[model samples]
Target: MNATAKLDEYIPVVGQAIIDDLKLLAERLAQKHVLHVNSTAVGGGVAEILSRMVPLLGEMGINTKWEVIKGGDQFYQVTKKFHNVLHGRPDEVTPADFEIFMETSRKNIAEMNTDYDIVFIHDPQPIALIQKKGQNKWIWRCHIDVSKPHPIVWAFLKEFIVRYDASVFSAPSFSQQLPIRQALISPSIDPLSEKNRELSPEDVDRVLAKYQISRDKPIITQISRFDRLKDPVGVIEAFLMVRKYIDCQLILAGGTATDDPEGLQVLAEVKEKAADNPDIHILLLPQNDFEVNALQRGSDVIMQKSLKEGFGLTVSEALWKVKPVVAGNVGGIPLQIKHKYSGMLCNSVEGAAFALKQILNSPAFAKRLGENGREHIRNNFLLTRHLRDYMLLFLSLDYAEDLVYL
Candidate 1:
């Protein structure tokens, strides 16, 4: 995004009516101060979306500030365990983990003064910060899939979640029957960001050459963190199966998040599974979005076969680029893909392999899928719509009764 990007600048992409509505909404919430608190300022989908969201809120004339909490290695380790348990993984959260989380939360509560009209907390990292709430609105935004979390871990987190004015979920299934009002707000990708913006053919070629990745054959890519739940290993298995008939190369690329301690472990496991396959290109990228955009644009097909997900933002990103996507039929992926319409959704490795083969074998079908996908993302998953929903959420907070169904 440009340094001086205005909401008006998005008119060319999202049209004039959307921008006008945002201005009107901002006028309603004039002089109100909003604060957003999360763990990391970089990496992951939360940081990525907020990178665009905060500045746009300011452009709308709202006093918006984004703050990140400080944590040590142990604190992040405990939170990563909580993330896994929240994703329905087996309960391995020890008593020590709770102590670690609270110990760090106490320091954060003391050091940071969260005195604003509204304090918006993202995920469970800063969830305990609600203890300091005093006659102000607080929104807990859960960016993970907690549909079927481990009972004990849910009980532990639920204690803090219930204190908020409202909780926001990415999908309806993720909403747990919480006491507070709930809002279903899906995540989005910035169309103007370096990761999603348009790139020249030379730019794509330069990035491909820089990485020594040859597009001699068709390229299939899965851009995600080296997380176990993303199922990079299964992606490799599916690619190997597809390679038997269709000649193609696989690109497994992503950077680690500061809040996720299991990243390096997962990356190592992925490397071991990849072995000495010359066709597999595993790029451990930095927080570089331009190169990511270039790679995604250069690929023949994009895959986001996550075993568990909050809302697969990459699916939207790929679809926006008019790329055919093959993703897991889990979490929020189905919301973006309509099976044979926009893209293909699979349940297992065999299913994914079959889907990939279909796309590679049929050129006209792939083109039609990509065209439909771009339209789907333009209408429903753009940043403009996301901004509208959030402002509506802020307005809904003014109501006393259950009003956050926006």
Candidate 2:
């Protein structure tokens, strides 16, 4: 879809007030050049947001650019370990890991273009880009939960992070009380995107048929990367418990990110755990957005069994589709779900299974929850809201004293 047309759809929902607000913000930041640096241009949520955000920012008269840092296999492996450690996992991040990270960061620093008014650095992979920051408003956009990060890893990264003018985190709980100013900006899904757009029943069925997913039985699906933090294995365990009472199938589908070196290993472990279970489908999708939309639409119950989630975009995507989601009550999952109102929040596999069974058994209740969930996302988690928040944040950085004049 074109940029103007896509932004117009928000008129009915967010109304002219926000559009006008964006216009004023755009005018205020017209001369400002914004650049976003991340690891990949696809696969991850940061990329997905930038794909829609940068274009809109440009359309709004801001000079916006997106750049990705290149890293080797070993570098990515080290970054992946850092990702886990940041999520509170006790991964042994050796001294060699920091050395490799610095080596790659040095290479990226030497070659990267850092000529922008505001530099937004996304995640840990490209975080070191801030090391090369000059006279610019460099904002570190951390799309992960570092509430309980490994001391060693956090300390190592802190050397580069503390240099930023500001930092953005998804949730308040995810934020660390650093000396720098912090902004709470939640991640959002594009409703007009292939993954959340309105789909016809024929399209949904065609997608299911292509994947050989049977519609005869109730399908409980979780769409996330095959990562341990996503808890794909725990999703399987929850599915098994749900299957004891409900005759349903479980679909765990996701694609790997370029920077995530542990995807294949995690996928293999998930396959091993679901061995010989025909009812369980482990699909390694090729980052196809529409297929994910169809799978969520075709499912009777959608789940996000994330043990540690950085807002869990899949949950927002499912909720946008009006699907009753049973997600873990951790990180940003609760921010998306209001428990019994929008959707049920689960703490463990058993809790998730129980919630899944409830949703599967009561169609009316599930439908009601789905409708409410969709409304919740429509009001709060859409790309338009995210853009507004970002624009406000940008303007705030400029008018640091009286920014809340709105």
Candidate 3:
């Protein structure tokens, strides 16, 4: 089917009611320029969402644009440390680090064009853009779980964040008690995108062959960036424990983001930890969306063992592919997986290992979980739902006193 026809199919599922709501929102937002600013143009969830969302917003008759901020290695190192600290990690973010962030922001402030009716600044990386907030309505979108952010880092970013007209978060728990109005808007996956679309058996096998992944053993895969917060090493540890009980191969697949300098170091550490085990395949994929979709489809089981996460889009992606997932019960993961009903949620390495063993050993139970997971995603995590929520949010910014029901 063609792209337009495929998108049309969603209208029936999302219903005529939603289409009417979008039309109302589009009329209200017509000709209004919406600009999204972030750290990277590729990798990570924020970039992925904006790539699909900006175009869709434009198609809806809103003039939308995406802008990426440029920063040096030192800047990303400081931001990476801040990212860890925001996720409740005990990372020391010194005053000097704050100064570096400001220095980089100052450069971006002078270089970037902020001419738009509404400006959406994503995450802490480009958050300082609010410092240069012009006549536009600025919204700071925090995709991380800041329920327990390091006081120093939180205080540093909070000052800039409070300047925004409104704030957006993936989950309710991720929201902070900001003086400004906050909205709970979850990230979503494009069902028509290469990473979530249906793939044939041959296509799946071809991706596996290209990555040199064996199709002989049951494949347990975890697709995430090579970042410390993702705990790729911990995934390896859990896989090793599960391997003792189930004879399955593990795939630790990921790519690096330009805004994250720690990915290379984390990737190297994961490789070192899995060096003794040949079955533990560490495939460092590029930013190939179809390869990720095929890998998820080919896998017998999928895992997301993140120590800390923003939303873990990989979990939703795996669920959309109808694969049983074992994910860490942190951040937005619990919102995605309904414990044993849809998918298994784990709190520790041992818990993840146990869940992995359960799914691998019992085919019937795993199949049921996968079936339930697909339905869960179809209802909550699809891109159409996300688009509706965002358009509603944009309208709500204009009418915050009364609740706008779609």
The candidate that achieves the highest TM-score relative to the unseen native structure: 1
Q: Could you tell me how far off, in angstroms, the CA of residue 143 lies in candidate 1 after the best superposition?
A: 1.2
- Of candidates 2 and 1, the better by lDDT: 1
Give the TM-score ranking, best first.
1, 2, 3
Where does model 3 exceed 4 Å of error? Answer: 1-20, 69-81, 88-100, 103-115, 131-136, 210-217, 226-228, 255-278
Q: Write down the TM-score of every candidate.
A: 0.89, 0.87, 0.84
Tens digits of per-residue lDDT for model 2 on 264-336?
A: 8898899999997999998889868779889999998898888877777788888888899999888888899
Model 1 over residues 316-335: C-alpha lDDT tens digits?
99999999999998888999
The parts of candidate 2 lying over 4 Å away from their true place are 1-6, 12-17, 70-74, 94-96, 110-113, 129-135, 255-279, 401-403
The lDDT of each candidate is 0.90, 0.87, 0.85
Q: List the residue pairs that clash in candidate 1.
A: none
Give the lowest summed-lDDT range of ten residues in model 2. 1-10
Which candidate number maximizes lDDT?
1
lDDT of 3 at 127: 90
